[model samples]
Target: MAKTLSVAPKQPQSCAALLEKLSSVLPKGHQFGIYHLSTPPTKTDALCHPPPDQRPDRTYCENHFLAVTIKSESKPSSSEPHADWRPVIVLALEIFIFTTAYSSIFFVSKADSTGYLHLLNLPKGTPSPIREVSSAFLAYLIDKRRRKGIQTTVNLFARAQDQYLFPGSIKNGGKHVLDDRGLVKWWCRVLDPLLEEQQQKQGSPWQVVKGYLLIPGLDHYETRAFIPRTATSAANWVLGHPLEKISHYCQEYDWVPPRCLIPKYPDDPKSRYRDELDEEASNKEQNSGAWRSVKTLEQFWEMMSFRQECSSGRMTGFIWVVFDPKDAEVNRGRVGGTPMPNGTPDQAPPGTPSRNRHALSSATPKSSPKKTFGSPSKQADLGRVEQKKKAKDKKKKKKILKGPIIPRQPRIKTRQRNYLVDRPVSSAYYYWPAEGRGQKIVDESDYKRCTELLLRLDFATLDKAAGSTRRWIEEVGMGSQWGLDVQGKMEMPPAAQGSGTAAGVVNNLSGLVRKKPIEGSEGQGQNGAGVNMLGAGLVRKKRKESTDGAEPNTDGSSHPAPSTAEEPKVNMLGAGMVRKKPKLA
Candidate 1:
């Protein structure tokens, strides 16, 4: 029987028993159960009735940190376990958290360490423990958060690398780890099933499981393989990266720099030690370096390029996986918006109508302005009204949007492809600032089509993965414009458009049902990696056939010939051959 998932394992013994089965693949001491690094959230800590100051502590979604270790232990050509089962890691997880009744989760960075985490090779056809542990834990976190009644989109980065636990790629003989491209696909495949969890339910909070990939200097021709990536007329989904915030600040202000060497934040749960360091540095006047001299985001990236971890020839993919809430947009920017410019004139705000041109055109002309000295309240109210009008005018002027010179689109002669020329960068083996500028605003239908295609893709092999991408573009791109003006009053996502939403994973004793495949996706029941959309963990991999000119079995796998072995007393059965190692020799 397939074991069901539990978001929060209530019985420690049962959880321990289950984990013990996976002990060989789990990191040492972490094999038993999850270790929480954060305090539980409380109800009183969420957004106040009327939204209060935008601070992390009182945010609607509370951020939390989680860490886990896993690795695939494949055998080498020489009939031994693949070397490099353990290599020094630099965490690719995704970051950049939460507490209120609703907790937002992100993997916290494990500070400054470089080393290998040993791997124990499991029986052949076993999936990589690394992907398993990571996926399972992430699913657990999502589910736990869902149970808390916190419905918000979850955002995190997924940069693929050999390992993510350590800072630098240590020189290890292990070459079994997936490369950057494979890592991204592998992550996608790993997380793809999560979508099934939401599609299974009518009111499932986890609505989408979309991915946004930004590899610098990649052109449309190259990037077309990964859905529509750059910004177009429709919706610019390629929101800027988090690191660029530092740069934005520098550009806006003559910002005195902090320790820019590491991308640690003061409120980061794991990196609270940064606060102590800041205090000490201030007391001793010891904070000084090129870090202090930095001014712009470009300089930040330039410096980041030199870091031991990033300098490696391996390109780090800037990826975003957003588990969006259909009704709950977690971003504080749009929440509790200011009542939309105070509605129409009839149901106008409960104040003196403004003397602005728009209001004056409709307002009944007052016979004479009754500005008596006795009525200070009216005068004061009028003065306040004038200030608000002035501020509104300034705001409008500041954001004066120039309408398109050619209002309606010119009639298509043959058919125009998307305008794919986003600002390209000069790739110089470094992470440039604004790494995620290639934006695209896919329509809802296109977005759904692309995500479905991506899920159907078989990333089992390079050839399959390539073929899948070709199929994806051919099918999803047919009659689909990458740029289309959003016409409806749709609940569209902001700048980060390419993502699918999956707010929480199935954490408890229930399996998610995969949604009925849409029309064309029915035949696309392809599989990648050893994954079940239900995320029950430890699924068996379908081993490949040998390339040595042997015919594969009817099952698409080649069975190894059994070796003959002698029984000490009783004779062993026919075909069950297992011989004493080279008896004559």
Candidate 2:
């Protein structure tokens, strides 16, 4: 073979080069800008920042954008304006992270989409620019919060849609665009890498991510707004995504976890945002518990389908990044002196005198010995002894509660986990959940082959883009390194190629979902010859003629007589073809 030229991946694109590249790839007059809410809100102008986030931490993730655009007349002739790379208007897609009252508690609120996305008229598929910018900002928040020793959880919704801005998107979903279901998988792929990165570090407390789906009419009947005497119905339905990757991840943590989805407390501003905007409904749900009548997490998602957002034409997905620390006490098991679930120390039964204090205790006045005639000094000594005993009892009661002891009912008033048990870090109380041996796959070779290969190629330069298109096809299409779980073969070095969009077929979903294959189907199968029958072929089956004068049929059945004339055995052309009957005068 002629000496093969090695083609390496191009260096990372710089900010300036990236801006220019994005400007060219994206439509004219559009800029790929990023804006985020500044902490303390005071740093950002009032236009970008809103009122207080109603959070104790003084952190607000939502900020509106001014619909400002650069006119062609005012646009700079040179690339000087792109040098700063700072956004004048940030399209804020809000993701709030409120630490709630405790670590066990988390909040995921959904509001109307206030993002200034009108500027972006890109085609279908969640663009990498949007994904990267949004993910990076949230990742920064999570990292910042985690560094401060706060538990971090991420949340997002999945609703596959064509370009919300472009008018042509309605007619053309564009090629290779992901659908609603695929969007769920795509997002998981996008975020899974982040979770893995965190895992490789000091260990990410979040090990699981669950997606709750809402499909109206298909899941449950329409969730009509009706008043109930009791809070017996729930608006939060829980039809989770059917992706094995997430299900397996969840299994590793809680095999059959309690279906406790998002909690919708009465008038809870943090949980119900968009729905609570209706003052009448807010007050009604406040009184009726938001119709939160679902008994399990699964039911919550089923009910969610009835919402206007997830009506007959739309589907909504709610995702949660679950945080469960590995150092949870489940592995070591609770040691002695572990306080009960309540803030109070492990209780002694009411019948047990050693732990329980009853009315018959000696501390009561009735238990005191009757006053008897005695010296004045002896009577004074007895009174002083009673006072000392009372003081000692008071001291013991104070020790029972390490801090303020608030009695709570199950989910309502439960104390934090580990109670008073000590840990390496005082704030590290994440020792929670079961210790079952969940399915653990240490090897990530499949992740590299399956997940990593599915990412979109970077298109910093035009020539590189065409070459990458071919390289992606050759490496991925051929299964150059084979097998699902086994280590793939060595990656083939990139070969030299001419510029221009690579000429090849691109297989896609074709606006159809893949289902289980028939027993034998040439039309289906991923590895089948990429061919389809054009309406089951053009020819008709041969027709049989009926006998005019028929012989008497036997009990079994009469059969057609065999041809008596015989010919010399010889290979003949058109021997089996049916000939048309000739017409004669």
lDDT per residue (tens digit) for residues 223-288 in model 2: 222111123213222343432222211222221111212433222322353243224344443332
If scored against the real structure, what TM-score would every candidate get? 0.33, 0.34
Score candidate 2 by TM-score against the native: 0.34
What is the lDDT of every predicted structure here? Answer: 0.35, 0.33
Off by over 4 Å in 1: 1-96, 99-123, 147-175, 201-203, 207-209, 220-313, 329-585
Model 2 RMSD in Å is 25.6
lDDT (Cα) of model 1: 0.35
- Model 1, span 1-585: residue lDDT tens: 111222322221123322332343343322222222222222233221110111222342222223232333333542334454321121223222333323243433322112223333222333444565555545655554442123333333334444343212334433256666665555544554454445555776654444444444444455435433233311322323443221111222222233332233323321242333445454223322122233333444444444433455654444444555543332211111112132332342232223343443334232322211122123434666899999999887775568767667678679854322221221111111121111232333454464445445443332333344345444644644321111111222343222234253457743565655555454454662333364333333433454577764667556663354232465433333455576684
* Count of residue pairs whose backbone atoms collide, per candidate: 37, 14
